[model samples]
Each structure stands twice: as structure tokens, then as C-alpha cells.
Target: MSKRCFLIEASNQEATEGQIMTVVQSSASHPLYGDIVTIVGKNRVNDNPVIISAYSKDSCHLEAERPGIVVMPNSVEEVQKIVRLCSSTKTPIMPAGGRNGICGACLPRVTNAVMLDMINMNGIVNLDEDVMTITVEAGMRWAELIHRLDDKGYKLGFRGPYGGNAATVAGSVSINSMGYAASRFGPAPEGVVSLEVVLPNGEIVRTGSGWNPEAQIFTRYSSFADLTGIFLGDHGTLGVKTKVTFKIYPKAEFSTYIDLGYKNLKDATAAFLEIQKRGLTEELNCLLARESADTYFPGLLDSHPEINATIHCVIMETDKQLAERKVQIIRDIGLDLKGKDLGNFAAQIHWAEKFNEVQPMYNNGFWLNTCHLRPISRIPELMDRMRAIFKKYSLEKNGIKWIADALAVDRAYAAAWVTIFAPTKDKMELAEKAWNEMLDAAMETGGCPYWSGLLWEKRALEKVNDTFIQLYRTIKKSIDP
Candidate 1:
């Protein structure tokens, strides 16, 4: 089959004057191109420059090795066939979904890799109301899944990531994303009950209760070892998840949004931890600095000059009284911590535009996001250190902005997105230097990143325990090697 090959001249960081780049090659030249096209059809496979360039980078600032070809498989059988062919040919295969990851997790690490664009495989497989579970194809976007469940008066524990509008169910769970309702439901992986993964050898395996031929996907910790955990947050290293089953909950009828302002980070973080420990929020997030609050809410802090930090709480319950009671308890905690009631404008706006709030902020600058997990109690210390680093980098003088925002996860920890903004291309180098320093500071403060893409892999390897690294390497080699 013949396909259009466009040759373009572009300037890159490594480009010299008058350099030509060949991003795409004719399918006739690729040895495995015909084989992949045969499995998924020509319409579903492309080696065109336009398609390859689009998949070269994700939401992150870094771009890695681009795949030689991209293919969209519509069925599990097609995925298996493609994987088998790649495995036999000793070719690298990378699974990509949604392409909404802030880390470079979806980018191919090798040039010869086959990019399995899983978006086409997106489909709802089952919704077992009796079992209170929803099974969907791995490529299904979270926003669509949530909307479908909403129509049925049901919802997921952790609804989805902040990028839910474009983030896929498997994509968020694969990276253990914490967002939306994570204050009570924890990260995305906690809600997953089962997974249908295609291993590197092209063999299909079912995890959780699905292992039992007679049982449905009801629970994650059933039968032998918790195999489901192996692939959760594996960054698609262990296998390609083709299907996902998530535990569903009846839609909560009542919800209350509250925003509390504290004079200092210590008070704000204390109140946040108290509310989380009491399990009083469906969604909870905090801006631990006045700068962060200003960045997020703009001029709201002008009225409350005494407030240096702000906490936004979203409480949901089956009963209105229960939700109110939880809100009252949170209010009392905030009051005791010397927090001022800021009303629910911030919280309401955030909830109303959950999937959109963060994206639009990109207009402000290029974000060097240092997203990681850290203890709630240590947030004050972390902020102090972060401020020091920012000051050292003269970020404000350089016209670079920053925000330290945290989402309360589970009950005790927080998923912090310490973002550094580079408003112009000229400031990227300084922003990167500040970002790397902040990353080291976060690690020193006992923070752990959920996803180690091209951004955090090197730092994580350097800081991770030797024994843990060996064990992980052994597991990876055994599974994919």
C-alpha cells in the first residue's frame, strides 16, 4: 500500500542552519509496516510525519524518541497479534492512551518502537449494576465513563484525574493519578477492581477476581497475590491494559463546598490534615502559599489580606445531614486553627470546572510541574524549602511564576503539584534549573513521585533504595525481557 510521505524542514534545539529532517518514511521501506497494517488495516496504521510528530511529545515539556510508526488496534485480538509480531521481530512496542500525561510516560523511548494508539479500542464492555462495577476498555476516556455512570445514578470513587476530560481510565490508573475525589477515595488505582492486560509475550491475563472463570470482576484482592497492583502505576511497562473494571458507587445526593483561609501555611496544613483524617471531604485541595492562592484564584486574596494560605473542601454524602455535619466538623477545625471563612466561591468554581481549570493556566506560562506525594504534616517545611529555592533562582525577578498546590489523597498524604512557570521560551533554562532543584528538595523532604517518566526517572533511580531498585529491575526483566 502507498501512503503520503511529507518531508519538512524544521528548526529544533539540535538543528543547524538549513537542515532537513525526515520524520516519516514510506511504509514500503519498513519491514514490519505491512505486517502491522495487515493486523489492524491500513486506515488504522500510519507512518506519516504528521501523525508521528503529534505522538512525539505529551503534555510535558520534554520530547523523547519518536516511534517509527503508529497503529490503532480496535480489538484485543488485534492487539495480541501486533504484540506477537513485534515480540518475534525483536521490536519495541509502546502503548499510548489519551496522551494527556504531564510526564513523558506515553512517549516512545526507542525510535524503532511501534506506538500502539489505544484510543480506537475505547468501548464500554460491561456495567454490572448488580455487582456495582463498571468494566470499560482501557482506552476509554474518564470523562465519558463518568458521564455514562452519571446517567445511571452511579459514580466512581475517585471520579478521574484533573485531566479527566482527555485522560483515559487505564492511563490515569496506570500512573496512579490522584485528583477529583481523591480526598476520600485515594488515587485512581484504588478504585480499580480488575484489569485485562496483554503481556509482552502476547499472552492475555486477567487479574483480581476475574481469574476465577466462574466469578465476575468484583474485588482486587482476591485469590492468589494481588496481581492487579503489579500493573497499576507500572507506566505500561509490565503489560498493555486492554480492559479495566472499576468499583462504582451510587451518586451522592448531597455535597457542600467550603473554602477556608489561614494566616499561615502551618494553620492551613493543620486544618487540611484534620479534615482529611476525619474523612470529611469528597475532594480537598490546598494552596499553601499566598502566591499560589493568587495564581489560582487571581484577586480573591485582596479582600482577605490576613489570609496567607487557602484550603478548598468539597464534602459529599448520601444524606444532606451527613454532608452538612461533616462540613460543620471541618469548619470547626478550621476555626480552631485560626482560619477565616472564605466562602465557597473558589471551591465551587473548581468543582464546576474540574477538568478545565488547570489547562487554561498554561496561558500564563510553560509549567515545569513537580508532581509528587508528600506527607501533610511536612507540607509547611516543604513550602519553606521551595520558597528558598525560588528565591535563590530569583524566579520573580526573572518573570517566572510559581505555585505550590496540594490535593489531599487518601487520609494522611497529599499529591502536590509544585509548578514553576516560564512565561517565555527564553526563561525555560532558568525554569528547568529551578525545577530540578525543587525536585531534589521534594525528595529530601520525603516526597515520592507517582509517575517516573522521562522527567523523574533519573532522580528517582538515584534516590530509590538499592534493594528496591534491584527487585523492580528483576521483576521488569522477568516480565518484559
Candidate 2:
């Protein structure tokens, strides 16, 4: 197998071997330093077999400025100690919680700095079902938490697909992740009731009702002007999260999957918006794209090939006896537009397969998958512009192929996922250009990109409304400065 190279540019310049070793020894001698092993042996962060020639004796660049490191922090005191040292030395620190961040948020900056990995701190501290809160160490796996909660007949609202198994509760909140159930419960940040953050100055700050009166929201009851919100999505730039307490919800009473196929992306999004606008179900998860429908349901795949040009599937659940009635409403919406319903049996079976099937989608194929986020209401416009762009890319001989899907956030909000496949590298570039145009068009229609925090490029970010960016900047300066 050939190894692919990832392009990286460091905001901070790389340090020399002598300087790197000096920094390493400084931390190694610090009181908080538990295990200071050099980045030696074989590198496993990116899983690529390529040899890195420009690396220092212990460290190597994996992606962009992200240098991977493994650290063993034995205690909270140790974490605080390291933070103090990093702050005093002016070294950037990146935290790794379970090493499952797809966007390289945990990857170290290009400078000769320490990467604090919180894998060893996986402990469930307290489970207070009375108030419906679970307090666990920052490194605890979400799946373990879900398993424990399931034993008690409850679970967290957003467990994030299969990635939850390798994900940490603190990491999810830090990244502001909104998994499958994001529409109803909101993102991970909203679920967090309190946070335990180790500041760069070696001080531990505990936020929320843990420190002060519940009614008093004006006071800086926690630490440094109430910086929990700042630290949540800082991408580990500000500080390290040691412990977290968040809300949980009961499992659904009943769940059903309904499949709807459309002749094109426009019709598919129309059906999705219809269900979202009409409140067709309490909990909804939908997958749209004719390709997915064809792959998941081959029987209908051939009979309704044109119907799949835009494929749609919905997952809805309710406790009431009128469950079928609600599903019928969704079915009716689909049927009204000449859409075909593959019924719930296929949807149920797909959900059962879950992430086991999703992970493989990114591997073992000559195709590429990229997505864009937009406000739910503007999905139709986005689709129209995207199809034109796809057509433009398809003029080449490689024969560009693609599929689009949309997930409804609410009546007025939604995110669309577009998958593109092309045979030539130039065609892929053209396809990427289309994706960017789609992203720009989405922003013009009041749609915010779903995960734009760690991409490093600020082009799409600059398109977001200035007010939110100002708020983000203020928070970053306060907590991370």
C-alpha cells in the first residue's frame, strides 16, 4: 500500500533539536512530569506507514502543525503541574481525550510543545440519577458511560455514532459536537451542566452551581471571569478539562425507520423539510441519497433507479399508540411528491448495523466523501446550486458522481451532507471547488457550517455573521490568552 502525505503549515515555527530537548527536559524535571518518554519507537497516530525524515529524535509531524505525543498524567495535581509549567515556559499544549478527534483537534501545534493525553483518567466519579447528572473523569469513554447508564435504564442524549466508543465526554463537549440526536437535545456543550478545567497557571476552576448560589448568574463565581464556555470549544488551546458533569435522558419508548426515495436532490430535501416543518416525529434521524437507498435496499434499487437520484430515510419514535399514524404522515408527504416508501423494516435493520457500517464507507474505495453545512430552510437553494456545480465538474471524462442528504436541526435550521466521486485528481479539485461554492451559498442563506472550528482555513468562517465571531474571539482571548 502506498502512503499519502498530508499538508501542514505551522503557525509557530519548529524548534531545533537542542531547543526541543531543552523543552523536554524542562518538563521532565517539573514536579508534574509523570512520564517523559520521547517520541520514539514507531509512530501510530495517523496509521500511515510512510517514513518521516524531517522529524526530531523523539517527535514527528503527523498532520499540519499536529505533532502527536503520549503522556501519562497520574493525577489531577499532575495535570495542573504540567499546565503551570507550559504557561510559565510559553509552550502551547494540546489535550488528547481518547485520540478519536477526526479533525486533528488533539494534534499538537508545530512548536516543540507537550501533548497532554487524558486516556488514563477514565473513572466514573459519581452517578446522581436523582438530579440526572453523571460526573466522570475527563478521559472516560462515552460508550462505558452509556453502558452504565443503560444498566440503569437511561442514557446520554448524544452518544455520537460509533465514534462514541473511542470518544471522551469532555472531548465531545470541548468540540461542541452534535451527534445524531442533535436536533432535539442540542449539541454536547448544551448538555454540560458544569466543568472542571485546569488553567495554564496551575489553578483548577470549577464552574456552575458547584461553587455559588444557583440564582446568582452575574457574579464570576467560578474562576477568571467564568471561562467554562470559553474552554468548551477552544480545541484544547486554552486549558485541559479534567472532569465533567452533564445531563442524561431516558431511552425512547419506541423507534421506527421510514424510507423515502426521490427523483432528485430537490425533491428529497423538500420531503425532509416537510417532515421537519410539520413535526412528523419526536426523535428523527434521516439519511438522504439515491446511492444510499440503492446500497441499503437493492430490491427497490433497480426498480426505482431514478427515484434514488435523491434517497431519503427517517428514524422516528414515539410512546403513544398512534405511532403508525405519525409515520403515515411522513409517508403521505413522500407519496404526495411521487416518492416511494421502502417501509420501516429496512430502516430498522440499517440502524441496527449502525457505525459498524459507517466507518467502512471512508475506506477501501476509490471515491472521496466531503460535506457542507447549511441552514435547513435553504436546503433547496443549496441543492440547486450544488447540482449545477456537480454538472460543471462532470464535464470531464472521469464521470463525476455524487449524492446529497440533509439532516433537519429544527424548523428553521438544518445541515446538508454531499458525497462526491470522481476518477481524476483534477476532477476531484473541481468537485471540491463545487463543495466550497456550496458552502459559500449556504452561508449566504443564513446556514452555519456544522464543524468549522479546526479546519485552519478562515475563508468560510469569515462568511459567518460577525457578531458570533466577535463573541468567539472574546471568549478565546479571555480563556486562552
Candidate 3:
């Protein structure tokens, strides 16, 4: 921990860099600190992790809150010990997983906080063949997990975001993440069966069937209440997730793409709503707005200049006939809405090149995208507000673009996201302003942003009811105390 200076006003935000430097230097004296350091090893725990090291760089856009000390525990017991140590020291502990999240959720808002890098904690706990479930430590990345499961002839219904190579399983659960195969099985919350959490006070609580020794890991329902929901999408406010359990699925029998080109946003969004109502697609995503298609996909808009919004859908079924029929249903609706069938070849290519198709690699360079979750019906207004924000910030030339992705879950729709590539320092500032405005517009349109990371805390506060906030505060105090 370096003695870097952190300036502050009288109100809000705790700890100066100088204080963090002093505190962490003296943290070794805490009662259990020595044991934890000895177990986790000082090398992995004392300094910042490499993934978030560039967090201090303004141009990096990592939004990592300044960290005092980082701890990487390899086992559940080690995590418990570390949590207990932080609890006793009255230190705020923030957990970071893969450092791939855009919402700044892993960053510590409270100054001089402890960063619990969970990568070392990853381990395969169990694979119950009969129950079709697997128990894994929190830090397992989706790529590794998927490969492991595939080798065993099994797969998950829900999965990590496009950045699955670095996205953590527990992190996905906490954020209610959406990504590939989502149209078939919903998001992170749907597949999760249980979680083992270390509360802020260092107490380890197992949700779901783990509570019953006789039927452990078999079921999530209880005679009293199912407690796993409390930890899902919690953003680490209540506790640190140590382990996760979820059901596995047989690999999909068939999967293909369906492309629809709308002349304008209105018809395109209507087609989206129709497809959403049916909920048959394995994955549903669209590149709306000509600017977005041009800037991010470069040459894409040139090829489809007449298209206002291009939807690329993934159709899945056990048999080819069934899948083709589902495709017709969507095609009919899209045409009914005055949309043109752009053919599936283009969308199929994009689906095949899903992970590396280029949002982050535009003309200027790296890009940032912000998204909000709303109903299918409200997507039109949401997209309009996003356009307004880009116009207001004079950011259209900054390569600004937007999209909408339909959630695999029933009656669920996401107003996809707005993307802008700002390769330079000055342009990045403008893009960031556009991002904030995009969030505001989501709220104004009666929609909530995707993740409740630190970035959206203030906006959430403004819209969240006081009673719910009070209850949350009370719960945080009780478990975290």
C-alpha cells in the first residue's frame, strides 16, 4: 500500500489514501490478521490484483475504487477467516471477480477497504449425476466451467456475459447476468439452486438444501422459506459469496439464427415485443440505429443501408422441423410489423463470432457500453431517450450506438445498451456523460438499469421506495454488524 494522497471535502466518502496507507500497514496487528496472511500468503494478499491495477488510469474506465489491501483466499475456510478478520477490524471488504464487470460493483466505495479477490477460491466441489447439479466455488470462470461440464456431457441453461473468459460464476449470480442461451433458460437467477455466503460479520450461512443434512444439495425449497434469493443480485452488500450450486442441462439439440430488418425503430421494437411474448428464441439480440451498426460493426450499415434495425435471433429446438416452425412464427410477426427478412446468414455469422465481433474494437479503439432492463413495450421510448442523450452531448461523432436484447425469461425485456468508443482522454469524458444521461433516461422511462453497481446507486435511491430502502438498511445492519 503506497502513501498516495486522496483529497476529500467535509461530506461523504471515507478514508484518504494517506489513511489507507497507514491503516493497512498496521493491519498485521489485528487478532486474526497474522493467521490469514500466513494461510493466504502475503504475496497474493497485500497488493492490488493485476486485473484491476489499471483501475487508477482515468482512460482505462475500470472505475475501481481505491483499495487498501487485497486478500486472495484459496478455500472456504480461508475466506471465512479473512471475513472474520475484516469484521473484527471494522474494515469494509469488497469482493472482485475477474474484474470484467462494467458497473463498478467490485470497487470499494468506502475508502481503505479490503479487496477480496476470489480467483484463488475457485474449486469444483461436487457433481451430482442423479440430481443433475454441480457445486462449485465462487471464483470459477464461465469458460472453464463450461468446458468442464461439456467434457462430462452436461451444460448449464444460463451462462456468463460475452466476456465469459474472465467472468466469474458467483459474480454472474450476484449481478443477475444475461448472455448466450439466455432465451432458453433465463438469466443467472433462474439456474441458481443454492449459495454458501459469508455474511459481513463473518458468519457462514448455507441457503437451500444445504440446511438439511439428510437431503443436502437435493432441493432449494424449504418448509419455511427459500433464502437463496436474498444473495442473488445483492452486489455484495449483504455478504461475500463463497460457493454456488446450479442444475445442469443436456446440450441443445438444434440452434440457428433468424435475421429481421426493420425499416425503422417503431416496427423493429414491435417485432421484438412479439418475439418476446412467444419466448421461443435461444438467444435474441438486435443492432438497432444505423449509427450503431456503422460505428461498431463498420461496413455493416453500408451493406444494409436500408435497414433501420437488424435483429439477429438464435432459434433452438429438439428437431429441425420444430426449430423451422418457430422461425416462421417470428418471421411472420416481423413481416406483419412491416419488417424485411434480412436472412439468417448474417446473424449466423455474428452468432458464430459472438465473443470477438468487435464492440470494443471500433475505429478509434476500446469502447464502453451501458444498459438498462425494461419491459419490451417501453423499449421505443428508452431508445429515443438514448438518442436524445447522444445528441445533447454532441457524441454521435464519438461513434455512439445502441441496441436491445430480449431476456430469455418470460415477460422480460432489456433495452440492450448504448455504446461509444472514446480512444482519447477528452472524448472519453464526453462518452461518460452520455452514459450517465442514458441511465437517467432509463429511469425517466420507468425502467431500472441492469446492474445496481455504485454508478446507479444514486438513481436507484431516487426511485426506490423509502420503506424498501429502510428494510434493506436494517437487514444490512443486522447481518453485517
Number of the top-ranking candidate, with TM-score as the measure:
1
Candidate 3 clashes between residue pairs 3 or more apart in a chain or in different chains? 183-408
lDDT of 1 by residue, 141-221 (tens): 888888888897899999888898989998999998889999999999999999999999999999999888877677888
Put down candidate 2 lDDT per residue, 137-196, tens digits, no spaces: 888777787777778677776655336767788778787665555555556676777778
In what order do the candidates fall by TM-score, top score first? Answer: 1, 3, 2
Tell me model 2's lDDT, rounded to 2 decimals: 0.57
Instruction: Please provide TM-scores, in order, for all candidate models, with all chains considered together.
Output: 0.93, 0.75, 0.86
Candidate 3 local lDDT, 1-481, one digit each (tens): 1122111122111222111122233335334445556766554455434423533322236565676666666666667777887887887888878777767778787666777778765667777776777888888888888878878777887766777777799888888787776766777777888899988767788888889756647577777587898889888788889889888876666776778888887788788877877887877776667665554455655666778877778886668898888888888888888988877876677667655554355555445666667776777777778777767877756654444343434446753666566666767777777777776777888777667776577888887888998998887787876
lDDT rank, highest first?
1, 3, 2
How badly does each model clash, as a count of residue pairs?
0, 6, 1
lDDT against the true structure, each candidate: 0.86, 0.57, 0.70
Report the Cα lDDT for residue 119, model 1.
78
Candidate 3 residue 267 C-alpha distance from true site, Å:
0.7
lDDT, candidate 2, at 206: 75
